[model samples]
Target: MPERVSRQLVYLVYGGKVEYHQEAKYSILSALHHAQGACPRILLYTDEPAQFIGWPVDVITLDDQILRAWTGPATYLHRRKAAAIRDALQYAEQSIFIDTDTFFLASPVKLFERLAKAPWLVDEIEGVWKEYEGDELHTVLAPYLAEQHGIDQRMLLINSGVLGFQGDASQLMDETLNLIDIMHPMVPKIHIIEQFAVSVAARHLGRPAESRGVIKHYFSGKNYWRHMVAAFFLRHGESFSAQAIEAVREVPTDKPRPVWWHRLNFRLRSVFLSSRMRSHAKLAYYATVLCADPYAKACGQGYAQELRRKAIPEGESLSIQPWSRVLTRQQKQRLAKLLGESATGHIP
Candidate 1:
């Protein structure tokens, strides 16, 4: 018989909010089934391991004592995400720490293969940390980065939701941890410090992370996407482990197919709201826009509406296209029913 080859990829997941828990289940289910020729192990680090009792993942129960020892008394909650990646270094040669709010559209074998050919892989390659006048981090951390590393800032910004590495990227993880240690004293909470840290280390590694849209982030559009998942669970909402998994395979993620009307609408919206406000104003404006969709926004689920702020007159990219029509009457009605709204669509 031909010798069997060892698997080349490992799917690493972590975290423990109710939303985090549900999405983690969705992420693992999607990843394992879609992996083409490899059946990689899925390692989950969570405080509530029992919640995933029967799921096909190796659960490492992360209790308080272990966390304190690992991170050394830091109260920053998100620091654990980076720490998880650092710890995952021991288990596999190739590992990806995926965010809970993501789902795989296809096998990650190609992605792992790509990582083998590069220093690191990030979900989306972006310019958020560059020398742009609007980049907030440039003003805050650039001096420290310049003084220490002889670089103004990490050039290749990335959406760190899906962080993949082929070898011991401990230097990268240490950089991330160091960034958090330095910045935690200044900021109320160190949000997204890991991305910047990884960018710094990736720069040291001397390559840009490849942009592979293999996994779709329902992150911005999750309010609507959450409704679809809830609908799928139907009566199975009670137990995530025993819930039917196949229907989650059908959540509609197709970007609004471009149409002439959509282009015109995009143009009109651009002309009307086109002035590029400073980043603060843009964030404030997006927060207000989110209010237009009340149900999911309040619970902190939807934020995709902000895409309209970046829309333009001539761009064909769906990334800048607002949902145009978020929901038809029928779709809203279904969501209403899911939320236990009445026939008249009134919430009590």
Candidate 2:
């Protein structure tokens, strides 16, 4: 086997939110967990460096001016990701920038190995451009893209949740930034334009590889994961230690999947409820029934409350009476029992 090249695991955490910084910390811990004694140089580029005071990583402090400049003329937020990758390249032979929402399932050495062959690592190939031509993302700009950027059926639509490349791929990052600048204003509503740029630019180099097997990006189920991450910090505190690293293994790496009976029960009970209420019902189900584990149940309860808050109209007093009105007497009692309520009236 060829000797491995020096690599750095890079993360970008701005906005100075505690939740987001904590999420990035979990991801970093997961990498360290799977490092198996071969940990890379971990680099964190953030506006708030104080959040990771005790963490074993290089903190590249980013100020507002640099962030604004990286955003460029279009003021596209995601443009910073490309620019961040470009800056991180100077620190190592290969830079693997993983989003804060991701967790490692395998040793990151596998990621570097893939980069050795493919040179680019993206979250996943969602589909070809033609498959989504008529979707909300492309409805406004498909024709223009086809004419201007040669976007077609063969053009890949990639998820940029985990983006990586070697130092030699600086030109690819530059082209990605150029594509972002050119496309952002025209397709501002298309949130993944930066991802599209990465896909297209890397396509020009060669087919970019997917990293799903090595890491899990919970972008689709972000709220659930966020609640779980927050609960983790609340439980163990934010300090990074050997004990904290061991504690990370106790947090569930994936959300619990609802069983067939649980799904059927939720559908039957919530059929009469409005779409908004039914959504909360699923969360309630996860909290009370599916997530018997203490940590996940805590997250599920948080999600249930969050959904319930959103369901209420503005200026109205928050109460469970509205949620209970749609339920039959027997159904209310049943739901109350399932949710561990002492009485049917307590169903909330």
Q: Candidate 1 lDDT, tens digit per residue, 42-129?
A: 7778778788777776767778787766553456667777787787776666677777777778786767776778877878877745
Where is model 1 poorest over a 10-residue stretch in terms of lDDT? 299-308
The lDDT per prediction is 0.57, 0.76
Which stretches of candidate 1 lie above 4 Å from their native place?
Answer: 1-16, 69-74, 132-135, 235-245, 255-348
The candidate maximizing lDDT is 2
lDDT of 2 by residue, 250-315 (tens): 888778656678778778877888887777656555545546665666566555555445554444
As a whole number from 0 to 100, the lDDT of residue 166 in candidate 1 is 62
Superposed by TM-score, candidate 1 places the C-alpha of residue 200 at a distance from the truth, in angstroms, of: 1.5
TM-score of each: 0.68, 0.84
lDDT, model 1: 0.57
| Backbone N/Cα/C clashes per model | 0, 0
